[model samples]
Target: MTRRNRSGSIGFIVDDLNPMLRGWFNYFKHAYRTEYREIDGFIRRRLRAILLRHNKRKGLGITLDAHCQWTNAYFAELGLFTMHEARVLACRPR
Candidate 1:
């Protein structure tokens, strides 16, 4: 996904990512909590990088702004599926 088209809109990127994230999470639902957290962070960081590159911005101010603004909930709002959330749901008693 690192090579994902930076020209695409964030919504388009999220739409492309959700299915892959869901499938991978389903397969590794039983993995350790820390592992899920780690992977989740990695994915979010990569997405942030994509966002930063898409915006064509540089310097710490923009980077910090992006990190602060484009948070987990923001991504969730954009329909980005999170592995940590999926794990919690999978482990929940129904």
Candidate 2:
């Protein structure tokens, strides 16, 4: 499906990197270990939960290559992942 993104570009600053690594690493750890396995629901439900606290203007999907890289850096600065990445990760095949 087509996803929406916010206008303008996003960037990263040095101060926010640590928290971003912590948060994303925490998320990756839980996800890799199948922490959400017992929860019976749509992927969107879990995806939404993961992304609910993040910025919504960055679009979603694997097609977002450069955008995703910029977003990762930007959110890393902001100490969060772009909501779009959550959607992409959720939609990704196991």
Candidate 3:
């Protein structure tokens, strides 16, 4: 989803990504020791990179600034699926 020339809103990308993430999470939910946090972080980092590129900026300072601006909560608001949440829900007793 981090294609350099990809055009469209972040919402569009998240909409396309959600289903794939859900399917993958369902299939792998049985793995009790999976590092969902790391997976979520990786996804978020790629998303951050996309945002950075979209804004045509670079450098560690801008990257850190972006992190503060576009936080995980911001992505959640955009409906980006998170593996960490999936893990929590999957582990909950019904």
* Backbone clashes, candidate 3: 0
Candidate 3, 1-94: lDDT as tens digits: 5564467778888888889888878887878436778888888887887788778787553366788989999999998898888787867899
**After aligning candidate 1 to the native by TM-score, how far in Å is the CA of 55 from where it should be?**
1.4
TM values, all candidates: 0.82, 0.22, 0.85
Ranking by TM-score: 3, 1, 2
Cα lDDT tens digits, model 2, 24-87, are: 5456654554433322122233233234323443544423443444444444454543434454
Which segments of model 3 are wrong by more than 4 Å? 60-62
Candidate 1 scores a C-alpha RMSD against the true structure in Å of 2.4
* Winner by TM-score between candidate 3 and candidate 2: 3
Worst 10 residues of 1 by lDDT: 55-64
Where in model 2 is the C-alpha error above 4 Å?
1-72
lDDT of 1 by residue, 19-65 (tens): 98888887877665668888887777778877777877664433667
True-vs-predicted CA distance for residue 54, candidate 1, Å: 1.6
Cα-lDDT of candidate 2: 0.38
